[model samples]
Target: MVARSFFALCLAAVAAAHGDHDHDQDPIAGPLQALWYNTLPGDGGTQADSVFSGISTFGRLPYLPCLNHRGINYDIAFIGAPFDTGTSYRPGARFGPSGIRQGSRRLNLYGGYNVPLDTNPFNSWAKVIDCGDIPVTSYDNTFALHQIEEGHFSILSRAPKTDATKKGPSLLGKTLPRVITLGGDHTITLPLLRSINRAYGPVSVIHFDSHLDTWRPKVFGGSPSEVASVNHGTYFYHAAQEGLLRNDSNIHAGIRTTLSGPSDYENDGYCGFEIVEAREIDTIGTDGIIKRIRDRVGTSNPVYLSLDIDTLDPAFAPATGTPETGGWSTRELRTILRGLDGINLIAADIVEVAPAYDTNAEHTTMAAADSLYEIMSIMVKRGPLSVMDGEKEEDL
Candidate 1:
């Protein structure tokens, strides 16, 4: 009892000592004031949040529901399509959008600059924003595709941001805002191309993949339903049928997948795309590959670049829905993309990232994010496409 009473007395004495002096007065207050006064304005979190600190958007970009335009304008927008029902093998690419964004958290930190490009896209004239994921239905593939199309078209239809009003290479007279999609799967590209067709008519495509995605739907053993036929493997064929692609102008790179037969190559040609097989990367090299792509698509045509994560070797990007071995390294791919620097790359998508198969270090997701950073850098370097300073829209 005596010991307990002594303990109580000691606690009371400590409390009295702590409360005796006020933090708001004298020495304590002066130092606190100094610390507060010396602290920077954004130190509390506005201009410089920790890379891991907030809701993940691609590159930590501003989040906007671009589908609800409401007078909102942007030069570039990153839209997320989180539907992956079209996958033929693996199925978790539905989670790709969020996974890619998480991988991109470090992108805009450290001044958001690209030294080689000598520009910072985030700080440049482009008003870039992240339009959160399209609320696509998982139950119905056809309806989900419709939703994706509608969402994409809504963004494509928006007027460009004031500073980014440079004319595009499209048939449209006014400037068109560019959309860099974080894809659900390769199937999303069909709807994306449909939206692009509405804005720019049939544009040339620069397809990067380990598989010849231009396969005819019949090759997949004839689906019972029409919607079932239009999948990742066959969306490009549908795009061709819908007149969404420019004939003889499209090209496929990094193709190394097995085909039904030699007729598959003929079908790919019929779909209006020439192939640069994956094995050629050994003999022709990245520079040669880039030259072939540039030669096929030309420098002035508005190009829609669709990159499948599986284009990178499984050693580098194994987390994709349909990863194949003997594909390009991330470095080789990025270098080739850099080679297309001056070409009219209008819009792009990086798809087929199924994070369910990823490593704990997120190699596949990081590859996708870094590839986007390179693509975004390329876009920034080119600035917005224009129809020459004083040229009229119809003179071409």
Candidate 2:
């Protein structure tokens, strides 16, 4: 009887020890338990239901409805200027913003490339939000331009309040949210420049295109009764005439299109921009091209980069309205852009992506989307600009 009682006591002790050991072990061991632990109900919990539902925004990012342009709480606004009335050849770039956004879905939350300068902008300190397409007037070009300018101005006019104690990338000790515009067409750049010029007078331009786009406005051949005639090819001419460009600092790269006459070059020169022909890539090389760009723009001037999809050879990007045969390849453009780190880039746009012309591969829109990401990475690395009393000043 005593032996039986002792055996029962020993079994009880062993059971207690085993229970204690189990209690000390982690509750979440297998994949199912880990998933359950991570997906609990509350803040910081994963919601499987809303994983990928809803309207697709840029890069599938969180959509902040900015219909009235109020409650703006982001460092970078990805806005769509969806009007292609300004196109000279094709009429489908109005769909560019959507196409670019769709292509961006393929990008993960990691750095775009393996290069030293290719960090992910979204993962940086900057807060970005997609503020859907601006409501442009389909019938009236002047009204559409006005709306586009106002949309940009509304975002630029207000500077986010930053903690003065912390030192980081910002404009004038404050954090002013920069704008990365997904364009309708190249002509949209004219109004964008207008809005930017209002805040930081006469900034330099880094124009990438197959054509100079500095053609005379008379090329449009509109009646005197019509609204101020403007097209993708001639907006820069107007921009120059209005003193909105730093003529001595602006530049055009990857131009291979035939000029109307020698006066075209003369006019472009008068606007204060040097041209780097497409074939020059072979002669001077990528490094030399980057040097020329940096030397021309300098380090202090506020720069606006406008990339026309036509800058890529049609073989690679055939969806643009004006595809030149001899142009920079995708790899060359990526290297050149990566080399342009540390420039004071304030505002940027990627335009002229007519997705309708894109092949089954969707190469044009994908290139545009990737190029946009590259530009955004550059901006994030540069950080915010220095503004003083509602104006952008050169960094001291």
Candidate 3:
């Protein structure tokens, strides 16, 4: 009780201070449109700006996240969970989200279908913003888990959850913003899913990974024990036991590994929707994959996409702990992302981008950033900028 009360007071104080700061910074730049630096070729990094310059007036800023278009402020928070403690082998994913965001300098607002940019369809209904990283401890294992659990729940409350917007915040008449997270590793998704399930009923997960993380007690040795297996290897099994996942709707993509989970597949379930090898990418392609994804998850269901960096080929994403050789290329992965535009995706996480493996640090973070852009583009196309001042829907 004391901890909850103290946290609540801290939140109120932080909110008050943020309100004052936003009021000051926002008036300088009225609306956030993708600026010129974004469109111009040969741009170095994400350029932070207080004013909209260049052509089209839709330059995506680097430093500042979330925009207060019109009178309402959208909470498109981009939080980083740099947690590598749960990892069994490699352990530098804590820097994954930030590294990706840093590399996402030029984001494509238009879909590959060549959707006209001047009149993009998705801007009206959504208002996206990046809230930055949550407050968490770095080294302390127990403290990190507690912070990841509590810290994310607070951010989750700010999201629209089931409805398009949330009520009860001081933001009042406007819609509460949606929070997007770039996780440290796959374990971060467990706490995040728990928070979302508590707010909204059982949600479907569209997971993309190289391995099946459904083994409850991961054992890598002769049998499935802690000595053989560890934390990062078993998320799906834990989530299912915790009842945070809807087994029917969950879909796993770009999987090119051999997993041996006995009862997880539900009589040949394939350990939560496994797509072995590059065969799916070759035979069905992105469109076929998208259709299959939509078929499994359905269109209207809210989705939380957890994309492990190992899903990409080692040539493209070489910074993961377990890198499979014949994974899909980056462009192939991007095509899958663009195909799923406007499919009720709530939040996303790009995990397992270990910077240490890549001496150049080019492929891993770059691929991860590009994957994150897919979610950003999907959200942007869903009317993030076009949403008007909406009264909080009580029933929602």
lDDT of 3 at 330: 93
- Please give, for residues 87-202, the per-residue lDDT of candidate 2 as tens digits: 76778888999988877865543323335574667666567778888888879998998999999878766654232233323333344567888889888999999998887778
Of candidates 3 and 1, the better by TM-score: 1
lDDT of 1: 0.85
**Could you tell me the lDDT of residue 67 within candidate 1?**
75
Can you write out model 1's per-residue Cα lDDT over 11-53, one digit (the tens) per residue? Answer: 9999888788554333211122345555766544223346767
User: Per-residue lDDT tens digits of candidate 3, residues 1-396?
Assistant: 999999999999999999986774322222333565567667545543322232221124333322222232444556677787778677888877666664553343322223432222223334444555666676665566667766666665554522344332222333344566776877777777777676555668888887777755634323345323335666666677677776678888877676565453442253345443456878877788888888887766666788898988998888887788888889888888788765666667778888778647477776777676666666655533113223222221
> How many backbone clashes are present in model 2?
8
Number of backbone clashes in candidate 3: 33
RMSD of 1: 13.0
List TM-scores for all candidates, in order: 0.85, 0.81, 0.69
Stretches of candidate 2 above 4 Å error?
1-54, 67-69, 109-114, 161-175, 220-228, 387-396
The lowest-lDDT stretch of 10 consecutive residues in candidate 3 is: 50-59
> lDDT values of the candidates?
0.85, 0.78, 0.62
Per-residue lDDT value at 17 in model 2: 94
Q: Where does model 3 exceed 4 Å of error? A: 1-73, 108-127, 159-176, 218-230, 261-277, 359-361, 384-396
Candidate order, lDDT descending: 1, 2, 3
Clashing residue pairs, candidate 2? 169-384, 170-384, 171-385, 171-386, 171-387, 172-386, 172-387, 247-272
Worst 10 residues of 1 by lDDT: 24-33
